[model samples]
Target: MNVYFLSGLGADKRVFSQLTLDDQFIIHHIEWIKPLKKELLSHYAGRLVAQIDTTQAFQLVGLSFGGIIASELSNIVHPEQIVIISSTPTGVPISKFYRGLVKFLLLSPFAAPLLKSTNSLTYKFFGADTPELKTLLKDILHDTDSKFLKWALIRMSSWERKTRAENLYHIHGSADRLISIKLVKPDVVIEGGGHLMVYAQAKQISAILNKKLKSEEY
Candidate 1:
């Protein structure tokens, strides 16, 4: 099976480097394109899906912001499986803080530049504890395209889509700072995991994926 992988907000494929997928699955990293002026989430996802080879049997694996995109993409073309890490499906209960942020703030039009400074506050927020992980986060942030980041951030903040796909499988963290676990009843939960658990708890996540996704015949 071929699995298309999407990264987090302002992040790239490096975030999934640690995942150990089943031998039968091949990984294809999806890239973010520049958002059209005031484009809707579904419209942007339609553009993104052009990169996928819809003719083949495939799955989708997305983390954080990427998960949001995956959810929308699922509507365009049905995938065999959609495994989302550290993310919530659209219409699921979102935290009060997030709701407030979205309701009060104007998103999409805002632009977030690639950050050069890897501040301690940023590390604490993302749960990057070790030096290597911090370096990894820093590099990802540095490479992120500002315009696309801003566009995604805004769209995420104001998202209102509420639909579920049958093949969607969500994996969340108990200690995730951004999205509260109380708000979501995920298929699998990583105890003491944080927003960055995709990298921090890759081993455990990989195990769960193998069991839930890979163990079965698609």
Candidate 2:
């Protein structure tokens, strides 16, 4: 099976480096593109459809904001299945408080640098406890484009999708501070897993994927 992966907000393919799947799965990483000013999330997802090889059957795996993008893509392209890790299928789980925060950030001068800075707060929120995980998170944050980050934040905070695909499988962390488990009900929950559990708990996630993806059932 050909599986296309979408990384988190402003993250790259490195986020999925720890995941190991069976040889039968051919993995492809989808790169994020620049969003046009005031572009709708659905429109942005439609633009992304160009990258997918729709001629053949494929599955999707998304993380964080990427999962939201996957949900949008599912509306445009019919994939065999969708596995979202540390993410939600709909934006209903996002708190309205974030919308105000995004507006404030856009107006504040310190917002750009603050969003790019990887500090203890960022670490705590992301649950990057280990030194290696902290470093990786720091690098990812540093490399993220401020404009893109702001754009995604605005779109994500205001997203209003209320439905999900029938073939969608959600995997969430119990301790994820960013997207609290209390907000949404996931198909599978990883104990002690946090926002970065896809990296920290790769072994467990990989095992789950192996079983879930191989099964004939959704």
Candidate 3:
């Protein structure tokens, strides 16, 4: 089986480096493309799907923003299995107060300044509490384009998965701060693991994929 892994927002292929899959599967890393000016999430997902070879039997494993992209891509091809890690099928739930604040930022050009000020909060939300993680996060944030950041933030805030496909599986961490675990029904729950569980619990993800693949093959 061929497995395509999609990384989270502002992250690259390195996020899945820790996952060790069996020889039965070939892993492909799908990178994110810059969203076209004023592009919708569905349209962006279509572009992402175009990067894949849809003729083969494959599995999709996505984390965070990639999970949402994978969910949209799943409508284009029927993969043997679809696994979402550390993400929600429905958009992340926003509190009433936060919703207003998000709208204000997304609607104004001052969004970039606001985001810069929240770098520390972003680090904590993504489960990067260590000094090293904080430094790495700062670098990532610095490299990100402000326009793209604003677009992604608005996209995430407006996203809604009204209908889910069958055979969809979710693997989430109970301690996720970015996306609420309560909003999703995960097949597996890793206690104490946070939003970056894809890195912290890669072996467990690989094991789950192995078992699921074996079952499908039989």
Residue-by-residue lDDT tens digits, candidate 2, 1-218: 78899999999999988988998788899999999989999999999999899998889999999999999998899999999999988876546687787778775877889998988999999999999999999999999988889889888889888888769999999999999999889999999999999999999999999887873553
lDDT of 3 by residue, 1-218 (tens): 78888877777776677777788778888977889988998888888877788888788888888888888888777777778888777766667678778868677877776675536678778787667556656666666677777877778887867776556788889889988777788888988778876776778777876777653662
Candidate 3: segments with Cα more than 4 A from true spot: 92-100, 113-120, 214-218
| Best by the lDDT measure | 2
Clashes of each: 1, 0, 0
Against the true structure, candidate 1 reaches a TM-score of 0.88
Number of residue pairs clashing in candidate 3, backbone atoms closer than 3 angstroms, sequence gap of 3 or more or interchain: 0
lDDT of 3: 0.77
Off by over 4 Å in 2: 93-98, 215-218
Order of candidate numbers by lDDT, starting with the best: 2, 1, 3
Name the regions of candidate 1 deviating beyond 4 angstroms: 92-117
Clashing pairs in model 1? 108-154
Q: Comparing candidate 1 with candidate 2, which one achieves the higher lDDT?
A: 2
Question: Which of the two, 1 or 3, has more lDDT?
Answer: 1
lDDT of 1 at 28: 94
TM-scores of all predicted structures:
0.88, 0.95, 0.86
